[model samples]
Each structure stands twice: as C-alpha cells, then as structure tokens.
Target: MEGLYIEPTETSPKVHFDPEAFSFEISGESRPEDVRKFYKPVLDWFEQYSNYLYWLTEKYAEGEKKLVQFHFVFEYFNSSSAKYIMDVIAKLGDIQKASPNAKIQILWHYDEPDEDMKEAGEEFETITNIPFKYIINPD
Candidate 1:
C-alpha cells in the first residue's frame, strides 16, 4: 500500500504515514479552521491501512507479527485539534485490541524545556491504553 503523506500547513502539522517503515508521524502546531476536514483523510487512511495489513497477513499466511509505530509531536494545538488527536490514538488502540498479534506504539515527542508539551503528552498517556514513550528533544 502506498503511504499517505501530507505536508505541514500554516495551521496544521506535517503528516508522514509510511507503511513500509511501519511508522506514522504528526508533528507541529494544529489549529485548522476546519478540524474535521483536516483530519478526516488521516482517519480514513488508518482504517484502510489496518484492513490492508490484516488481509495481507491472512492471505499470505505470514507468521511474522505486524507492528505500527505512531509518533505524535505537536508544539501546540487548539481544543478541536486535541480532540482529533485523541480520536486517532483511540483508533490505534482499537486496531491493537482487534489484532492481538499486532503491536502499536505511541511515541510522544516534546521539546525538553517545554513544560506544556510535556504535560500534554502525559494527559494523552492517561487517556489511551496504548504503550507510549515520552521523548524530550532539545530545540
């Protein structure tokens, strides 16, 4: 499956969903005027990717386990964007639950001295059951 890539906008983040790498990343500020519109495609892509992966494994009879890595690193976001972010995390949790053999990791990256970003990551961790890693990157 081809990867879904969206470049960062003035009011949005850079999105990189690479199936080959089994990695997805959303980073930067998000304050899009139309939150739903901006995130709908991303949500759809996740659903499609999950289904494709399931089919490929079942059809090919691959014994290897499939894992997806989601990286969320936002310097700031509005409340609406936050809701969408949470929704994405929930979707990933659902995928993991449905596919016991499939593991999903949520990596939350934040600026080392940014207290707000750190706290935000903690908040997400509390809400989602997915395994999360908090990474501090110095600007």
Candidate 2:
C-alpha cells in the first residue's frame, strides 16, 4: 500500500506512515485547530494498513514480525492533542492485541533536560502495553 507523508505546519506535526516498511512516525509540534479532523485520516490509514498486516500474516505466514516502529517527537502539544495521541496509542495497542507479531516500539523524543517530556513518555508507558523508548535530544 502507498504510504502517507504530511508536511508539518505551524499547528500540526509531520506525519509518515509507511506500511510497506512497517513503520510510522509523527514529529514536530501538534496543536492543530481541529485535532480530530487532523488525526482522523491518520486513524483511517492505520486501520487499513492494520487489516493488510493481519491478512498478510494469516494467509501466507504465521509468526512473522509485525513490528511497527513508531516515533513521536513533539516539541510541544496542547492538552487537546493528548487525547488524539492516546487514540493513536490505543489503536496501536489494538493492532498488537490482534496479532502476536504486532509489537510496536514507540520512541518518544524530547529535548535535553526536559523532565516533563520524559515524564509524559513514562506516563504513556504506564497507560499502554506498547513498549516505549525515551530519547533525549542531543541538541
């Protein structure tokens, strides 16, 4: 399937969802005017890709890794954006639950000395079963 690549704007984050490579990433800031509208396509695309993944595994091969590496690098986001983020995470969790090979590694990137950002990542780790890798920016 073709991938999704949305450029970042003043209010939205950069998005890259590549099912061919089995990866997804969202970076930059996310405080769009309509959070649901902005993220709806993302959810839609993921649902389609997830169905493909399940079909591929069930028909041809079983136990193949459905590892979708997801990166979330947010410099800043509003409280409203948090709800959308959780939606993405929950969808990922559903993908994981549907397939044993569906393991998602979420890498949360924050600037150095940004304890709040780190804490946010930790909070996500507690909220979902998706494994998280917290990364501190070098710059």
lDDT per model vs. reference: 0.83, 0.83
Clashes of 2: 0
Tell me the tens digit of each residue's lDDT in model 1 across 35-128: 9999999999989877766665554334667656788889889998988998898888877766655667888888888888878777877898
TM-score per candidate, chains pooled: 0.88, 0.89
Cα error, candidate 2, residue 109 (Å): 1.3
TM-score of 2: 0.89
How far off is residue 118 in model 1, in Å? 1.8
- Which runs of model 1 end up more than 4 angstroms from their true locations? 57-64
Q: Please name the candidate that would achieve the greatest TM-score relative to the true structure.
A: 2
Identify the runs in model 2 with alpha carbons over 4 angstroms from their true place: 59-64
Error of 1 at 111 (Å): 0.5
